[model samples]
Target: MASDHVAEFEAHRPRLFAVGYRLLGSAAEAEDLVQETFLRWNDADRDVVRTPAAWLTKVLTNLCLNRLASARSRREDYVGIWLPEPVMTDDSALGPLETAERRESVSLAMLVLMEKLTPVERAVFVLREAFGYRHREIAEILDITESNSQQVLRRAQAHLRERPRFDASGDQRRRIAELFLDAARGGDLPALERLLADDVVSSADGGGVAGAARNAIRGASRVARYFAGLLDVPLPGLELRVVELNGQPGILAVVGDALVSVTVVEVGDERVRRIYNVVNPDKLRFLAAQCGLVARNWRQVIEDTSGSVMELRAARFRE
Candidate 1:
């Protein structure tokens, strides 16, 4: 009987992982939460779990909400800017990211924007918006009234709306991404300007261990200059690979066997609106694993980076 119960939980493990990962951006943290949930499930009486999936979801959601609440203050003291661990995602990992709405829910931009939501709001938003849970189902999982769930969802949507999220379709983004990379590859000033929007913003996450822009660069010309300058000083054995990141096209930079960075862009109107450069070595583990390579060695990665923009990015990895 115990083994049967364990098998049932294992069957839902992927779904549980998805719930945890989307709610909490760190894959490592999500694995921890899922493992804890399994322990609780093992101890639970099988007869009492009328719907195992709902029971596990409720448990996972609460655990993530608690973690998010605590993580807020820690992020405040974080070294430099903190970005979500870039994931090389698949259909089973987060969900079928077939539609723009579904895909954007798990996008880096969306994950970052979720920071603004209150713990309850975040829970409601993820459950209702991403998972398609009914208000009553969310109410049960969150231990709130149906009306409260609806109100929270409304507030979450409104708060998110105030913050503009890039809504460009995949086809639209791919078109702009290819051109954007072409300009950025050679540091083409005129081409970079033509590809960027007037009010473009560029941000990087070095986690203080890696060198990165301490502050966001705004305006098209400035954004253009930032990337052009970065590409100007090429690291030895630098290789660029085009890949899909969180349902949108992105670039992966590898030096020999080590991954240097994963860059993604938000595009609209045939111009790039935002550029997200993730240079933190700690966050590239999954990218390295995906590319069948190891992360860049600290010493080797910094060889040509001295006196360059990368030298500025060699910030400490803030835990």
Candidate 2:
């Protein structure tokens, strides 16, 4: 019975980790929290529990709260800017809509905005918005009153209201990304400049764990210059291969068949608003296994989805 229950728990680990990662904004910490939750579940009397997933979520949320408390303290002493660990997963499993939803939720800009909320506020907001948990479920998870959960959610939503949301379809984004990639690969700075937002910003996360820009690159012209400058730096053997990252157009830097880095470009209102270059080896561990990367043609996928899983596939297609 115990072994069977463990198998059941393992099956849901991805969803739980996804929840934790959104709340905490750190993939490594999310995995740790999920692992700890399972350990607690394994040690507990399962016969006494009614909803195992709920129990695990509550346990994981509490652990994340504690971890966030400590993380804040440690971040204060951190040498430079702190970035959330990037998540690398197989994009083939997602339809275009699923990809877009996941990308929007995990975007670096979104993660940065999430940092504004207090840990409890973050937990409440994620539970209410991301997982669609009821106020009572969230209250139970946080050990707070239902009224408090509602209030926290209101504040979180208010804070998030300031950030603009993208409206382009998944097919549109993929097409736009392809054009941008073509311009960049062809060294057509003029075309690339046209696709970028006037005030675009770029950020790279090497975590100081590797070679990366320690700070964010701001302004559209500056970002264009940065990309243009890249062509000058002789990577002589490096090839820019475009792939679907987090459900958006991403470029992988391949050097003699080795995948070095993955970059995700954020598009807003038909303009490239931001670029997130993730070069951290640790964050790219999942991709490290694939010598030659592969992904579903999200644009094609979006256009052809008139089939059975339409609703389940909608969120992914609208990038």
Candidate 3:
């Protein structure tokens, strides 16, 4: 009986994590909620539980709603612009990214926009949009009427109506990221400006632990010059690479084995529309572990590399 319970929980672990992560936007917190859900599941009365999946979803979603309330309060005192904790999606850590909509649902841009939504609204939106939960199912999970669930989703969608959509193919995004990195490193403001949209916005979230811009930098020329100046300064042992972040092409900055920051670029109409730079050490913990940078000799791999910019794939990192 115990083994059967364990297997059942394991089967739903990935989906639970996926739902939790999208709701909270923090992998660490999502993991905590998932563990708590498992604990509850262990003690749950299986005889009365008609559907394990729905029961787990309700438990996890409630946990997230509680967390989101406190998280918003804490963010009031948070230092600088708080960006979502960046995660590598190549391994499907946050669930399937086979579709553009699924990928956008987890993007840093959409996550940031979601911050403006009420806890209930965010829950409804993520459930319906990301996971395809019906309004009736959402009502059950959220303990609201079906009509209320639909209304909440409408509000959430309206709030997120401005969310940027990336229509570029994966190869196109990678090529653009490569070009952006080269231009930034070489201090080529003209090239950078050419790639940026007229209203491009760049935000850096250092979370008060690392140096970053407190306010968002806007405009193509200003954002271009900012990156050019920032990346032109050479730091010994610093490496920049184009990698996949949250189902999109992004830049990872590292010095030795330590990850310095993750820059997630949003591309629209083949131009860079927004850049989210997360430099907070606390936010990097989960991703660093995923990349095997924790207590590993990954620095030796960097030392062997010839150039500052290269492709860092998941397999290469594990090797």
Candidate 4:
């Protein structure tokens, strides 16, 4: 019975982790939630639990909802733009991302947009949109009326309706990213400008330890120049690679023993609409570990470093 129970819990671990990651935007936190769920499941009466999957989903969702409530306050005072910790993921991790509707739910851009939602709304949105939970089931899981679940989901969707859709396929994303990087590297301002949306916005998240813009930079011309200037003043020892982050192709940067930064773009009509740069040391641990490096503050080592943007140095791109 004990072994069988463990097997049952393991089968649903992926879905639970998916919900936790989408809700909280932290892989470590998601794994922790999975552990917590297992603990509770171990003690749960298997016969009464009836549906292990549903029970686990409810437990994980509520756990994430509580965390999000507390997290919002902290983020308000965060050192810089708080982009989601970029994770190397695929459709198996975030569900089929081929369709805009499915992909949007996992995109870092949408996850950031979700930060604007209330905890209940965020839970409702994640459950309904990403997991395909029906309103009645969500209501049962959340302990809310079915109609209430529907309304909350509606409100959440309305808030997110204006965010850009991720329409580019994997090949297009890789091609566009290569072109953008090549232009930025060669300092070809015109080529970059042509690839940027008129209302393009770039956000940097260095989390104070690393040097980054304290505020977001917006506008096509401004953003294009920002990247050009960034290339003109590159950080030293920065190595770059192409990785799938948050279900999309993105650039990851590692400097020395630290994961310096990650940049993921949202492309529409074959042009970059938004660029999310995450440089927070706290958020780069997983990636650093993946690259066999330590995610630490190397900024102190090069505090006097000048004429270079601290986010990255001369980058080497690997597919």
Candidate 5:
């Protein structure tokens, strides 16, 4: 019976892993957390655990909480702007839950904001809001008083509610994404200027190993001027390809034989709100396998973003 129960528990692994990934924002760490949860089950005296799922969740959440606490220093030292690991999936494979996760999961703004939350706070809120876990169930999983769980969730929600909701259904977003790609890759300054809002913000993450702009670029004119200078750099075989990132259209630059960088455009109505360039090799691990690479090298120059501006170079891994 115990063996049977354990097998049954394995069936929920994907859902649990997704939960952990959503909270922790790292696929590798999420896998570790789920494995640890099951390990506890294997070692436990079954007579004590009345609810197996609850027990698993409790173990997992606590383990993640500890990991998150210890992870602060490493994240602080992370190069440039840190972006979420991009999950590559064809649109057809999306189930309702997966769709929801992709929509909410990869939002750069949302992910950054989540960093402000304590691990327990994130756990409580995700359990309650995303998984429909009641406060009582959440309390059991978190090993906190039900009221405490409720309080924590409330505080977490309050912090997250301030960001403007992203609407993914608009055609303007897709159209603008295409326009931005044309402008950015073709070196059409006028086309790029027309697409960008007057007050646009651009940020890049190059892991500091590469010469990326140390600060965020604000205002449309500055970004335009910067990109104009960038396009002049000699990247002979590089081309822009459109793909969906964070549930929206994005552009990736394939340089020579490697996919070097990804550009995510956040659109507001018909205007471009934000441009995020991910040059940090550490953040692109999720795409490593897809790029047919064996190991990721953070220092190699895969794409040159700093043409004449500040001499920034971006790299991605190739097998």
Candidate 6:
């Protein structure tokens, strides 16, 4: 019986983590919630549990909701712009990214927009949009009426209506990232400006620990000069590699075995619209450990950039 229980939880672990990560936007917190859910599952009366998956999801989601109340308080006092902690999505850590919607649901842009939502609204939106949960099912999980669930979802959508829509295809996005990388590294302000949209915006989250722009930098020319100036200064042993982050093309800055920063962009009409750089050491711990675990030698992976980006996809890193 114990073995059977363990097997059932194992089967649902991935999905639970997916929902948790999306709700909280912190892989480390999501992982902790998942473990706590398992403890509750073990303590619950299995005889009355009709569906294990639903039970586990409800437990995890509520855990996240409880955590979000406190999380928002922390963010209010957080230093600088607080960006969602990014995870390498090459291995589908947050769930299947086969569709554009699924990918967008977990993207850094969407995650940032979600911060504006109320806890209940965020829960309803994530359940309906990301996991395809029916209103009736959502009502059960959230202890609200079906109509209330639908209304909450609509409200959440309204809040997130400003989310950027990317016009670039996967290949185009990669190409743009590559070009941006080259231009930034070479300090080519003209090339950077040409690639940026007129209203391009750049924001950095350094958690006040690492040096970063305290305020968002806006406008194409200003943003271009910012990156040109930022990247032009050479730091010895700093390596930049283009890789998929949160299901979209992004760049990773690393020095030796340490991850220094992660940059993800939103492109529309083949022009870069928004650039998000996360340099907070606290946020980089999970991804940095992932890097160390997947690649035996970071230099080898960094040197071989000729192949497709998929070639460097980190094998699913387990906690």
Candidate that scores best on TM-score = 3
Clashes of each: 14, 8, 0, 2, 2, 0
lDDT per residue, candidate 2, 1-319, as tens digits?
8789889899778778878888787766787888998889889886777888888888888898998888888877754466665444444321123543455666667777888888998899777766679999998888899999999999998888755466777677778888877776677878888999888878876655556677888876677777765544344355786666654667777655455577777787998987887766666654545435432222222234433334434543664
All models: lDDT?
A: 0.80, 0.71, 0.87, 0.80, 0.69, 0.84
Off by over 4 Å in 3: 295-319
**Taking the tens digit of each residue's C-alpha lDDT, what string does model 3 give over 1-319?**
9999989999999999999989999999999999999999999999978899999999999999999999998999999999988899989888889998999999999999999999999999999999999999999999999999988988898998898688999989989989999998988889999999999999998878777899999999999989986764445677787889988888887776777678998888999998998878788888888887642122233445532323343333556
Error of 2 at 90 (Å): 5.8
Worst 10 residues of 4 by lDDT: 310-319
Report the C-alpha lDDT of model 1 over 107-194, residue by residue, as the tens digit. Answer: 7788888888898998899888778999999999999999999999999998898444556767777878888888888879899999
Q: Tell me the tens digit of each residue's lDDT in model 5 across 97-169.
A: 3544446545565666788888888888767765779998888777789899889988998888755355645
Off by over 4 Å in 6: 293-319
Model 6 lDDT per residue over 1-319, tens place: 9999999999999899889888998988998999999999999997878999889989999999999999999999999999987888887778778888888899888999999999899999999989999999999999999999988988998889897576678899989989998998888889999999898889998888777898999998999888887664335566899988887788988766667788997777998988999887778777777777221222333344323223333321221
User: TM-score of predicted model 3?
Assistant: 0.90
Error of 5 at 277 (Å): 1.9
**Candidate 6 Cα RMSD (Å):** 8.3
lDDT of 5 at 318: 19
Rank by TM-score, highest first: 3, 6, 1, 4, 2, 5
What TM-score, computed on C-alpha atoms, does each candidate reach? 0.89, 0.82, 0.90, 0.89, 0.80, 0.90
Stretches of model 5 off by over 4 angstroms after superposition = 1-10, 45-50, 89-102, 168-171, 228-231, 255-257, 290-319
C-alpha positional error of residue 289 in candidate 3 after TM-score superposition, expressed in Å = 1.0
Model 4 ranges with Cα > 4 A deviation: 233-237, 290-293, 298-319
C-alpha-based local distance difference test score of model 4: 0.80
